[model samples]
Structure formats: structure tokens, C-alpha cells
Target: MIGFSCYLSEPADEQQTAYLKQMQQAGFTGVFTSLQLPEDDPKTLRQRLNHLITSCHQLGLAVVADISLASLKRLGIAPRDCSGIEALQLDGVRIDDGIDMTTVAALSHTMGVALNASTLSAETIDQLANAKANLRHIEAWHNFYPRPETGLDPCWFQQKNHWLHTLGFKTMAFIPGDAQQRGPLFAGLPTLEPHRGLLPLAAYLDLKRLATDHVYIGDPQLSPRSIAAFQAYTSDQVLLIQTQTADDRLYHLTWHNRPDVAQQVVRLAEARLEHIFAAPEPHHTDERPRGSITLDNTRYGRYAGELQITRCDLPADPKVNVIGHVAPVALPLLDHVGPHQALRFKQ
Candidate 1:
């Protein structure tokens, strides 16, 4: 499942509500908010939280709030008694370190509960099981690191996710958004350090490969370009590649990787079909770097007009014309294009 953050630190206004709707239309089905801000006025926090939850409910988005004992007290709801919580129409509550297992287990029966993925231990899992927690409503959620170097190591994260799967627990992680990053430390919230600067989709794909069941945008918003890319991906199963420059003949058409695949580059299957495009005379035989969009020149015989996206750096070849390059921020996506995957270029 894909989700995005909608913090309550600011007022829940029409703008924020509209963003929720935009995100829902873009294929996001969940909203994560935090009610643990101690600095905010309690009354104001309650009002904002209520408004946010109402908007989510109306939009048919699942809403989960990160809660602490103080925040719960501010809302005048006792943790053990879930009646108040149910009335608020929350889909779930993320329990922090201080919350006891009995409470966590009890909350699971009433609503969804997310436990800290990083600190969860075998003993704690045993305790939750012994307490008869509703396993179906419980998931492990990794915290997003606001500090640059504190994010979880990718290898450790993958291993931990594997362990969680063995124990029948769904897992979630965060990736930073491209716009309106959260304040105090704007360095991006990510579960893996390397993901801190990646585009939202690239980081999300990485997390999926790492065995995460759900991915959330840690920051407040995504740039328009990122949103469009995600929309294309979710709605059409097409990988959108932003290029510095592209030949309109190739860029305008959706190309698919050859069924047989290639080790060093993405081979466009239709590029070599007869009458697809005019055989190009070699003009720009620039060195083929990774992410370069290249077309086979007339000197390559029947292979002329064949198009390929380089997967690794290659020396300049007279038979190939380097046409364009994938945007640097999007280079990470080159490694993920699978056999027969559809690719569309955006200049």
C-alpha cells in the first residue's frame, strides 16, 4: 500500500484537504499523522486532529495517527478504553516505546496498531502474542530518520523485513518527498540513508525490493513532476523517464524492453522493426554512458535504427548515435526496468 504524511502541526485547511484528495486520486490510499507534538496547544491540536480525520474519512483514506500517552490524555481518552478512539473514526494508532504490550494488544482488537519495527524484539513479539493481540491488525512500522546518517542500513533493513515476514507481520517504511520537507531538519525522512535524496518513486521501488509491504512519503508533499510519474506508473504500469533531450520520434512513443532482455542495456523491441523510423546516419557518436538513449546508426547494417538505453558506461561507437540521457535524479530507475517493461520519456 502507498501512503503519505499529513501532519497536524499546521492548521487543517482547505489546501491541506485538497492535497489529500489529490494524493488519493494519485493512487495513495492511506494518511499518516502525528498527534504527539507537545509544544502545540492541546486544544488546537485536538481541533486540527479532528478536522484531519474527518477529511480523511470523507475521502475514503485510511488514517493512522502516531500517539503518545500525553497526546492521548490531551484528547481526554484513556488508552485502555477504545470507545473514545472509535468515536473519532480513526483507522489505527501508532504506539510508541512507552505504551505497554497489554494496551497495544487491546488496541489491536479495537483498531489497527503499528509497533516500532526497529526496536521490536523476539521477547516483545512473544509478549504481544501471549497477550492475545489481534495479529491481523498489527504491523511493524519503521521510523523515518530526520537526521542524515541515522537512517537504517539497507542490508539490516532487508534482513529485518525478512524476519518480520517469517513472523507474519506486515512492514512499512518511509521515503522523503521532493517538496515542502518537514522543518527543524529539512534533510528528508527516510528509512534507508541512501534514499534521503532520491525521488519519491525511486525510493519507494527500492523499499519494495527490500520487502516492505507499505511505503509512505515522509515529507509533506511531492513535486508536480514526481506526482505525474507516480500517476503514470500506478495507472498505466509505465516507467516514466525524464530525459535532458530526446528525439520526438522515440520519446513520443511508449517503448517496451525486448522479451529476451539484455545484460548491459534496455533494448527497445520495436525499434528495429521495418518501417518504424528512418535509418539514421551517424551524427553524434558520443560516448555511451549509463542512462544514455542511443540509436543504432546506418553503419550497423540491419541493426540500424535499433534503440537502446545503456545500463552501464560504454565507449563511443561509430555505429551508435547518443541522443539523450536520463535525468540524473532518475538514473537510479534505470536499474529497475524489467524485461518487457513499458518506458515513456518526458523531456
Candidate 2:
């Protein structure tokens, strides 16, 4: 499942509601919110939580809250008395530290519960099982590290996920958002340290490769371009790559990678078949770096009109014209494109 975050640090407003709807329309299925923010007023938290939940329900988005014993107490909701939680109509609740195993097991029966994936031990699993927890509704969610260099290591995360799967738990992780990053430390929030500065889509794809069942945006907002890219990828199976220089000849067309994938670059399937560009001489035969969008000239004989996006840096070639480069935000996306992958260029 794909999701995004919304926080209660401030009251919900028209803009926040619109953002939720916008994200829902863009193919996000769920939202992750926290009820334990240190700065929120107890009264205001209740009001904002109600507004957020109502909006999510109307939009068909699942709501999950990250909560702790103190936060629940501040709201006057007891650990055992989940009726208050149920009244909020949340699809799930994430249990933070200081919440006991019995409470975790109880909450599972009442609503979906997400345990910390990194710290959940075999002993705790045994304890929950012995407590007769409804394990079917349980999932493991990794925390998004706010501090730089503190995020989980990729290898260790993968190994932990393998074990979690063996114990029959689905896994979720977080990736940073590019637009309006969450503050305090205005750096990105990511489950994997290496993903901190990467684009959200790239970080998400990496998590998928690592066997994550769900991925959420750790920050509260995503740039409109990123949202559109996600919408295109999910709805039409196309990667919408933003370009630095708009080539009128190529920007309006949809391109596909060759079925027989190349080793160093993505070969455009239709480029060779179409007699589009004039039989020409290469003018900008500059060094073709990764993400360079190039078109072969007539100097290459039958290979003319072969358009490709370089996957790795290569020396300049007189036969190829570097027309443009994919926008830096989308450079990481090149690594995920495979054979026959549909790609569309956007300004």
C-alpha cells in the first residue's frame, strides 16, 4: 500500500483537507498521522484528529495513528478502553514504546496495530502469541529517523524484514517528501539513511525491492510533480520523467524502452522506426553522462534516429547528439526503468 503523512501539530484547515483529497486522487490509499506530538494542545489534538479522520473516511483513505500511553492519557483514553479510539474510526493504531505487550495484543483485536519493526524481538512475538493477540491484524512499521545518519542500515533492515516475514508480519517503511519537509531538523525523514536525500519515488522503489509491503511519505507534503509521477506510474504504468530542456519533438510523445534491454542505456523502441528528425550532423556531441537523452545522427548510418537515455557516463561521440538531460529529481528513476518500460517526458 502507498501512503502519506499528516500531522496534528496544527489544526486541520481547508488546505490540509484539499491535500488529502489530492493525494487520494493521486493513488495514495492511506495516511499515517501521529497523536503524540509534544507541542499539540490536548483539546486541539482531539479536534484536529476528528477533522482528519472524517476527511479521510469521506475520501476512502485509511487512517493510522502513532500513539503512546501519555498521549492517550492526555486525551483521557485508557489503554484498555479503545472505544474512544474506535469512535475516531481509525483503521489502525501504531503502538509506541511504554505501551505493554498486553495492550498491543488487546489493540490488535480492536483495531490494526503496528509494532516497531526494528525493535520487535522474538521474545515479544512469543509474548504476544501467548497473550492470544489477533495476529492477523498486526503489521510491523519501521520508524522514520529524524536525525541524519541514524536511519536503519539497508542490509540490516532487509535481514530484519526477512525475519518479520517468517513470523507472518507484513512490513512498512518511510521515505522522505521533497516539498515542505517536516521541521525541527528540516532534513528528510527516511527509514534507510542512504535514502535521506533521494527522491521519494526512488526511495519508494528501493524499499519495494527490499520486500517492503507498504511505503509512506515521512514528510507531510509531496511536490506536485512527484504526486503526478506517482499518479501516472500507478494508474497507467508509465514513468513520467521531467526534462531539463523541453524538446518539442519528443516531449509530446510516449516512448518505450526496447524489449531486449541494453547494458548501458535505455534504447527508445520507436526512435529507430520513425523517420522524425532530419538527417543531420551532431552539433552538441558533448560527454554523455547518466540521464543524458541522446539521438543518433545520420553519421551513424543505419543507427541514425536511435534515441537513448544514458544509464552511465560515457565519452562524447560524434554520432550522437545530447539533446537533453532528465531533471535531477528524476535521475534516480533511471535505475528503476527496465525492458519495455513506458516513459513520458514532461517539462
Q: Highest TM-score: give the candidate number.
A: 1
Instruction: Point out where model 2 deviates above 4 Å.
Output: none
Clashing pairs in 1: none
Residue 181 CA error for candidate 2 (Å)?
A: 1.4
Clash number for every model?
A: 0, 0
Report the lDDT tens digits of candidate 2 across residue range 18-65: 999999999999999998876778888889988999999999999999
Worst 10 residues of 2 by lDDT: 271-280
TM-score of each: 0.97, 0.96
Error of 1 at 214 (Å): 0.4
lDDT of 1 by residue, 142-182 (tens): 99999989999999999999999999999999999999999
